[model samples]
Target chain A: MRLAVTGAGAVGRSVVELAGEYGHEVVAVADSSSAVVADAGLDPEALVTRKAEAGVVGDGDPGDALAADYDVLVEATPTTLGDAEPGFSHVRTALERDRHAVLANKGPVAERYADLRALARDGDGDVRFEATVGGAIPAISTVEDVEPGHVTAVRGVLNGTANFILTRMAAEGLDYDHVLAEAQDLGVAEADPSFDVDGTDAALKCVILANVLSFGAADDPADAREFTLDDADVEGIRDVPGSALRLAAEDGRTVRLIGEATGGTVRVAPRLVPENGTLAVSGTQNIVQIETSHAGRLNISGLGAGGPETASAVLSDVGRLG
Target chain B: MSDAPDGAPEDPEGADEADPAVDGGHDPGSSTHTVRLELVDEPGQLLAALQPIADNGGNLLSIYHERGNKTPRGRIPVEVDFEATADRFEVIVGALRDEGIAVMQAGTERYAEELTLLLVGHLIDTDLSDTLSRIEADASTSVADVSLAAPQGTAEASSARLRLEARTGETADALETVRGIAEEKGLRVVAPLAGVET
Candidate 1:
């Protein structure tokens, strides 16, 4: 299959690299600034080097990649709220052209899932966004596999940055600020880490999953619509006092930032995860727990976000297009 | 472990079927052993104590986290029961202590055989709860079932039938605890029942 990626960030670069290793031809690749389009397969290595050296993937306009001859359009751009523009438009363009869209961006799914589905239905193309939620953890596919319409709830430790800070704070008895600084230095957190620390990233994933559990599966007769991030009740880990973790620790409990979506309601808050309980996962690890009517409770855990880790999910969705 | 927590198990209907250990459903290739650790009531300490069990290939059967019960060191006594091959048990225990956790005990738990005994004494004069506790302390013994025939009321002589599960080799240890309590309370002990002479 020929691939066209819209965002040449960490995840996009990884997808290109792995696609080459897996023998998939990437005919087009684009950064926000520029794009490289080839009627023949584009060199994945040259694209990576060009992005690093010139800050642009190639000299061609991104419009060319969008309209390029490709079977799949890989949307790996940053998430935007309101209309989820650019990523949304890129995906829509691919779908309108009867091309599959595999997204690592959260915006298109969380904000415009219904519209995307409608567009997909109107055209011959379909959309898959496994990387939007649990990176390479297979959260979306695992729940979908367990008989459609049986999922009662999906809860998880979705943000690895928050989990890393919390785990370090607890283990070292350091304050949140101290651990946060250490985390930032370790590249575990972004310099402006408000999005992750404020739980917006997690909320977006939860909202997307909530949309999937509710609006996905055309035959289920469940409401087919998007669940915007605004509908989620999100709280960040920024204000979780070290004293609170200490107190819970005294009771053999640990604090974890848990995002839960069930019954049309979604929330992200710091809660008492039992010390030895299944939710007491440490460091940057993530766990997505799905409760179903038929399969009982199933848990899947792995790296929630990373270059190769999240890219693996995007490529898996591409392979699945066949 | 403890019935898969309060709300975790999917089946509410057959949730209380039986304990997994007693059902002989446990893999015969591996045996059950309980590790006792006193953890500082800190956030990651429990995870710290439990990681080695998983790292050493010990499958956790149940965790008896005595959060309310603390040692003189102001730490909680957590008993984690797990299944591992005999060879891995030592490594698991070593890993637990190497994490700087206090391992109170780590050994095979054999409370499988059942034994019944009779104790006759003053109904309420001596504390029955204390007597029962002592009979179970540091021994592979648990009161599986009990019957008290106290027709004469709380102030009179009452005999109690106690059915206990014990490690076959450690039956004498359990019986000794009962005998010690019986001697202190001047209670007549009639042991060695017909069917449970072992």
Candidate 2:
């Protein structure tokens, strides 16, 4: 497959490396700083060095450089769902050119799923976004497996940094600040952790889920309720007697960062599960449990976040396309 | 703004000569209290925790059940909120412990809002279940709902959209946390468009 990769961030970098290994011809690479194109094929190793030196990837703007010939346009730009003009432009151009697309950026899809889907259909191209949600988890596939009419609700722990911090707090009894610092140091969190803590990320995700399960279209991020872990009073959890200790009680259950969409409304928050429940065992592990009208309750849990794991998912998509 | 003379509108009929004991009914300034408790993994643990609040003159307002998670000791953490007088609040805490419910943390603070996210990826192929578990471990957030779609099987490239709600105004952090997962798992994030002013 001839591929054009946009963004060059962590996921983009992984896609480039994997696509090269898979013997796919990476025709062009786009980013904010620079764009690299090769007729024969660019060396992933050399491109990495160039990216580091140039401090950018792809063309500064979406123009002929990205709109050039390609079989598949792989988008991996920074996700800005509502205001992702750059990603949207790049994707729109690729689709307009009758190229297939595999997206890692959430901005374009979250904001314009319906339009994009329609565009893809009109262009007779495939747009697959397995990496958009659940990291390496095959959540979309799971939902697809069940009868759409039978599925009643969807829920899970969708964020990793917040979970990492919560795990640290649960294990070490550390404050939010300390746990967050540790997450950054461990590379589990970003330098700017606002998105993870503020819940905007989760809201965007909810919009996507609602689109897939209910409307067959994504909703506006503004339409969903938003919250963040930062608003939680950890000190309050400690100040009260038996508060912190109860989390570790012999029969206590603790599950953090939960999201649920039931009926017509979608809600997300932190919840304490009863011991002996499936969620109670989901410690530092990403889990998604779906309740359906026919399947009752089904739970899926695994390591949904990580480079190699996510790369494998992308590779799977490439294989399927092949 | 007009200023009326003190005691000028005093009307004999409007004057209440009722009992002095009822001078001030239900002090509006009275502070509400909250309690955090840990319960054994039992079916009625939540009910056991709530009994204390009701028995101690506390009106239940909210409850935060940190379940489907575990502590280092493998126990569950639960946060409960209720309205009560200062004296009655303390009694509620005592009653919870007496009923064998592990009290974790409690105070006047309440979870005013929650945020949720749906993650789509090869959750099973990439071990997304573990990721969900890790996310739920965060004290600030909890796994409220999940929906998985793996029509091609777990090993195949698939997507699972997870919904996660966090404390009020914590959506940014929640998404960031998810971004970390996306970065780690190489998953494409397709929703929650940025800069939409949600």
Top model number, lDDT: 1
lDDT of 1 by residue, B1-198 (tens): 354543222433354555444433243345567766678888999898889998888788789998888753377988898776667877887687567676655564445455556566673578787877777675577664455665547755665666666775777778788877888887755453222111
Q: Write out the backbone clash pairs for model 1.
A: none
Tens digit of lDDT per residue, candidate 2, span A24-120? 8777888776787776777888777778887765444545447666788888888874557788788788888888888777677667776677678
Model 2 Cα lDDT, one tens digit per residue, B18-122 = 421132223332234556555667688778778878877776766777898765444677776555555676677667656756544445232233433334446
Q: State candidate 2's DockQ.
A: 0.03
For each candidate, the DockQ is: 0.02, 0.03
List model 1 lDDT by residue over A94-201, tens digit each.
999999999999998988878887898789998999999988899888867874478888888999999999999888877778999999999999998898899999
- Whole-model lDDT for model 2 versus the true structure? 0.61
Candidate 1 residue spans exceeding 4 A from truth: A217-222, B1-198
Model 1 global lDDT (CA atoms, 0 to 1): 0.78
Output the worst ten-in-a-row residue range by lDDT, candidate 2 chain B. Answer: B1-10
Candidate 2 chain A has its poorest 10 consecutive residues by lDDT at: A233-242
